[model samples]
Target: MDFKEKFSTIKKHLLTGTSHMIPFIVAGGILFSLAVMLNPEGAATPETGWLGDLASIGSAGLTLFVPVLGGYIAYSIADKPGLAPGMIGAYLASQVGAGFLGGIVAGFIAGYVVKALKKIKLPISLKSLGSIFLYPLFGTLITGGIIVWVIGTPISAIMEGLTGWLNSLSDAGKVPLASILGAMTAFDMGGPINKVATLFAQTQVDTLPYLMGGSRSSYLYTTNWNGNCNIVSSKKI
Candidate 1:
C-alpha cells in the first residue's frame, strides 16, 4: 500500500478502538464528576457513603479504559483471536504506568502477534489445540513480556518526563501550549486529529489537568460553532 492508504488503514483501526472506548470514558467521567460534585471536600473515603461508592465505580470504569481500548484495536486488526492478548497486554501496560499511548502500542503488538500465530501450520489434531490454547497462551506471554519488560519502563519514563515538563511550564508558556492543543482538538471534531489531542489529555489527566480543560473548552467552542452554522443554514431555507 502507498503511504496515504497505509495511514488511512492505521487511522481506521485506531478509530475502531477509540469508538469502542468512548462509552466507557463517558460513563466513567459522568460518575466521577458526580462523585466530586457530591463530595467536594475530598473526604469521601471508600466506606463513607454513596459518594464514595460513586467514586469507586467511576474509578473502576476508568481503570478498564486502557485494556478495552487495546483489546478492541486488536480486534479491529485480527478479529476475535486478538482480543484476549490485547487486553492482557494493555493491563500490563497500565500496571507499568505506560498509560494510553502504551495501550495503543500493546494493541498493535497483540494484533500482529495473533496474526503471525495464525500463519503457523499445525497437525490436524493440534489445530484445535492451537486455536483454543496455544495462540492465546503464547500471544499473551510474548505481548505481555515485551510490554512489561522491554517497553514499559522506557514509556513510563517518557510519560513522567512529559508530565513534569508540562507541570513546570511558565504561565506564558501554558497559554501557548493550551492554544495549540485547543486548536488541534477543535480542528476535526471527533476525527483522528481530535482524537490525538484527546488521547494525550486523557493520559495526562492526573498529572496535567490544564491540558484536558483546554481541549474540552475548545471542543465545546467548535461544536457550538458548528451547531450555529447548521441553524443559520436551515433558517435560510
Candidate 2:
C-alpha cells in the first residue's frame, strides 16, 4: 500500500481500540456517578459502605481503560502476540501520568515492534518458541523501555499541562470547547478527529466529570444517529 493508505490504517487501529473502550467508559461512569449521587455531602467517596464498593469497582474499570485501549490497538496491528506488550506499555503510561494520548503511543509502538520482531528468521525449533515466549518477552521489554525511559517524562509533562489547562478553563470557556468537540464529532462521524476528541474527554472522566458530561451527551446522540444510519444503509432504503 501507499504511504497514505498505510497512514490511514492508524485510524482503523485507533477506532478498534476506541470501540472496545466504550463499554468500560459507559459502565464505569454510570456506577461512579451513582456512588457520588448517593452521598449527600459529596464530602468524599464513602470508604466502607456499598457505595464505596461500587465506586471501587468503577474506579477499577476507569483505571484499566488505558491498558485496554493500548491492548486492542496493538491486537489490531499485530494480533494476539501484541496484546501483552501493549497492555504493559499502556499500564506504564498511566503510572507515569501519560494519559490516553500516551496509551495510543504505547499501543502503536508495541504493535510495530511486535510486527518487526515477527519478521526475524528463526530456526524451525526456535520458530515455535516465538509466539509463546520470544514475542511477549522482547515486545514488553522494548516497548516498556521506550515508555519508561524515552517518552515517559515528556508525555507526563504534557498530560500535566493539559490537565492544568482544562482545570483552569472557566465554565463559559467550556461551551466553545464542547461545541468544537461536537462539531468534530459531526464532521468526521467516527473518524480520527472524533477518536481524538473522545480520548481527550475520556482522559478527564474520572477527575472531572463535567467535562465528560458534555462529550457524553453528544456521544449518545451521535451513537443513536449512527445506528439508525447503519440500519438504513443495511436496508438500502
Candidate 3:
C-alpha cells in the first residue's frame, strides 16, 4: 500500500478497535462512576459491600476493554488468528502499566506478526496446526516479550509523568487542559476523536474527577445551551 492507503488502513484498524471497545468503556465507566457516586464514605474508590463489588466488576470490565481493543484491532488487520496474541500482549501491557497506548501498540504488533507468519511456506499437513498453534505461539512470544521487557517501563514512566504533570497543574494550566478536552468533546459529539479524548479522561477518572466532571461533560452542557440559544435566535415567524 502507498502512504495514503496505509494510513487509511491503519485508521480503519483503529476505528474497528475503538468501535468494539466502546461498549466496554461505556458500561464500565458508568458503573464505576455510579459506584463512586453512591459510596457513603465519598471515597474516590469504594471498598465495601455491593458498591465495592460493583466497582470491582466495573473495574474488571475497564481492564478487559484494553485487551478487547487490542484483540479486535488485530482481528481487523489479520482476522481471527491475531486475536489471541493481541489480547495476551495487551494483557501483559496492562500488567506492566503500559495502559491503552501500549495495548494499541501490541495490537498492531500482533496483527502484523500474525500476518507475516501467514506468509511462511508451511507443508499442507502442518497448515492447520500452524493456524492455531504456531501463529499465536510465536506472535505472543514476540509481542509479549517486547512489551514486558522493552517498551513497558518507558510507557509506564511516560504515563506516570503525564499524570504527575496534570496533578501539578495550577488553575492557569488547567484552563488550557480543560479547553482542549472540551474542544475534543464538542468536536464531533461522540465520534472517534471525542472517544479518544474520553478514553484518556476516563482512564484518569478514579484519580482526576475534574477531567470528567468539569472538563468533558460540563463543556457539552454549555455547548448545548449555546446551540439552543442559536436555534431560538435563528427561528423566524
Alpha-carbon TM-score of each model against the true structure: 0.82, 0.86, 0.82
- Sequence-dependent TM-score of model 1: 0.82
CA lDDT of every candidate: 0.78, 0.80, 0.79
> Model 1, which residues run further than 4 Å from truth?
40-47, 170-177, 188-191, 205-210, 217-237
- Candidate 3 C-alpha error for residue 11, in Å: 0.8
Model 1: colliding residue pairs: none
Q: How many clashing residue pairs are found in candidate 1?
A: 0
**Candidate with maximal TM-score:** 2
Off by over 4 Å in 2: 171-173, 216-237
Q: Clash number for model 3?
A: 0
- The 10 consecutive residues of candidate 2 with the worst lDDT sum are 228-237
lDDT of 1 by residue, 83-182 (tens): 9999999899999988888899999999899989989998898888876688878988999999988999898788778766666663557787787777
Candidate 2, pairs of clashing residues? none
